[model samples]
Target: MKNHQNPRRTFLKNAALSGALATLTSGVSLASSPSKRAVRRDFNLNYAPHFGMFKNHAGDDFVDQINFMAEQGFPALEDNGLMKRSLDDQKRIGAALEKNGMTMGVFVIDPGFNWKVALTTGKEEYKEAFVKECEKAVEVAKIVNAKWMTVVPGYFERNLPLDQQTAHIIDAYRMGAEVFEPHGLTMVMEPLSDNPHLYLRHSNQAYMICKAVDSPAVKILYDIYHMQRNEGNLIANMELCWEEIAYIQIGDNPGRKEPGTGEINYQNVFKWIDEKGFKGISGMEHGNASPGKEGEQALINAYHKADSFK
Candidate 1:
């Protein structure tokens, strides 16, 4: 049986999908040369790397990167901008992940999500857009064989009180939950710390929102980098939101790069998640600290070091 939802759409929305895939098949090596691996080894958990993270080693071909990740023992992948890619690319990547036994992690539900409109405004237009995006996310998830889609509830409304804004966000997410629950897809709410104006900035707030939504379809992303910046109690805050947390994303703070390049103690964090028996993907949603093959290898080595915890 074949799924026909997005088999061939040139793309009706604006996302980084095209930009990511446009260079996928270019065959350009970001490093001095392409990487050639002699063996494949499995990591401890399903830690997912994004598309261009290994372009130096894998070349610019997206499928080749997929192969390289598998060859390097990567068990999963996360594409934050995947929803913007073409349907063909989505299918190909999905097929590749399936063949390599790699899990597909979170991708943005809507590329138009970063705008200033508030879901907390109780505005019908904003709520409608959120619901539509949720519906589209279901279709996109089918194409990529993805179980999780990332969601941002939008910025805080300046005119609305904090409590009112929270309620509106909850109401909008409840509608989103209704759309996603039947498909068994989860919309993981991400509390970003990139800027101060954003609405959701803490794990506790996301946890409360998830509780308000009260559905398996809605959960928290629990990005380590953002949480570490927003608040210092990483382990405790995560434990508090543990029940509502559906996925995890990684980046060492001070620098949103791979494990060893910054202030985070990823080994401890990875070990903690491992001990907790989390069977979900930990998205490597950060940049390479070093450039070219050296950087890519460093990134890989960093993960290896972090995973060495027993």
Candidate 2:
């Protein structure tokens, strides 16, 4: 019952498995090739990328990544989590963007979850917290020369009437707008996909809130990815809410990845936006379906392909 394999045979079998694994991994690496040069395209405004997108090829350094993005012809960058970065890091990133001729896109001043506290509750403490955040956001905007910050109205208060909740959001946004107006900064409210419990979950809902806020500082951040998932008629909805939209974000639906990897006809979508004469940056807020440098190249290629629909 204690039969054992010969020593030489065992070694050979282990070696074979190790070699097979190495071969499989190498094949994957080759298939996911990296870009040899930055992608170049003819488009209006700038297509923004967040940090870590090019880290593998650019060596985990923000400056190098910015240089790579610039080389690829991207003229803008966005960081939703930029406020979490250290002050020195923010300054360095800002400098890199400037040196690369890139503009900063929207960064979070009061991402919906925290900012919504004031809008939903109307408690003085929460209102004070939100105002303080707005004050800090303005300072950060000045540091980076950022023009826009993303905002959200938070969860739907089940106990409150819908009209009452809407009124509360308006008050909170008006307060935020006042804080940003003096500094020439804008607060962009984003509508999330239908999750039932979420308060601000549609472009029309956001458009209405923007109207109620009644300030130029309050505008919409139209994220096509979320909208496609929430509402089907993309072009029509965008056109309808065009007046209040200040910025846009892009990602293919089903899988929040690059353009060509999903069902969204990004080429037509981009063309429509361009035809509409949008001047704001379209934040590339998705991930690559593939991995590593080659995947990155594919992502750039996809954008180029979609953007070439002129």
Candidate 3:
């Protein structure tokens, strides 16, 4: 039977067996070798992830976290409480960021805000204090090579007239702008939506303040999460204040988690911003939906999907 078999059939059977053997060998080789490290993909936007967002995957060490973020191609970082971190830690983080070629995002300049007299009351001491904080922010910015710092005008003063309060806030920002203007640093105003007591809660409000300040050093942070809560028309509001918008922060509404875990259509928003040629960083200022490494990976995947928009 073998002698009578056709040459074509024999060749075909041999070829099939050889191909299977080669595939099996390749599988074995791959399985035996150490798994290749994942290559970082270039994201469409400079999405700034805060420290500790990837702690589960990268550990609690700041340098490790920064390295992990770089490995995953996160081009920038924003830490609202960066000034509160120890000077040594700040230096270490700055070094890590520099080594990884990452951009430093916004850090909170005034942690002691939220007082009635801070910026709205027009108190001389309060204004001086805000300006002093701006000075300190300049020093911190020098350390981290940061260009933007977040400034919250603080709570509303019930005793003061609304117009007077607005004027005071504007004056305070103008004074604050003086400190960083020489250093080529910007203080991006953040409008909070947590409570009615807090002042500067809308994009238009921030836009007006930025206009009043009339300096490149004073611009709006344009936090999407808070804006979505305070005013539902995100894209329109974004466009209204597009010119003065220096930086952007991102968090989905209902739950301040990653994009896909909430109601915000981040794909459209990202696409719109990209189409507009926005060269600023969008800080991922939200929490993860789940816990541990799996959740961190999910958050990364969510951004990849959102940024896939053409």
Query: What ranges in model 3 sit over 4 Å off?
Result: 1-41, 111-114
Per-residue lDDT of model 1, residues 136-192, tens digit only? 888888876777889887777899899999999889998997887666677899999
Look at candidate 2 and tell me the lDDT of residue 279.
63
**Clash totals, every prediction:** 2, 7, 0
What's the CA error at residue 179 for candidate 1, in Å? 0.9
Native-vs-model 3 lDDT? 0.81
Per-residue lDDT of 127-208 in model 2, one digit per residue for the tens? 6777788888988877767878998777777778889889888888889888876555778999887476778888998998
Error of 1 at 26 (Å): 31
TM-score of 2: 0.84
Candidate 3 per-residue C-alpha lDDT over 1-310 given as tens digits, one digit per residue, 9 for 90 to 100: 2342557535543443343234212211223323322324368777999888999888989999988997988877888888899999999888776666677889988637557557888988888878888888888987877888888888888898889999998898889877876666778999988888898899999998887777767888998999999998889989999988878999998899999887899999999999988767789989998898899999999999999997
Decide which is better by lDDT, 1 or 2: 1
RMSD, every candidate, angstroms: 9.9, 20.8, 19.6
Better of 2 and 3 by lDDT: 3
Segments in model 2 whose C-alpha atoms lie over 4 Å from true places: 1-42, 111-118
Q: Which 10 consecutive residues of model 2 have the lowest summed lDDT?
A: 23-32
Show pairs that collide, candidate 2: 32-294, 33-293, 33-294, 34-293, 34-294, 38-72, 39-72
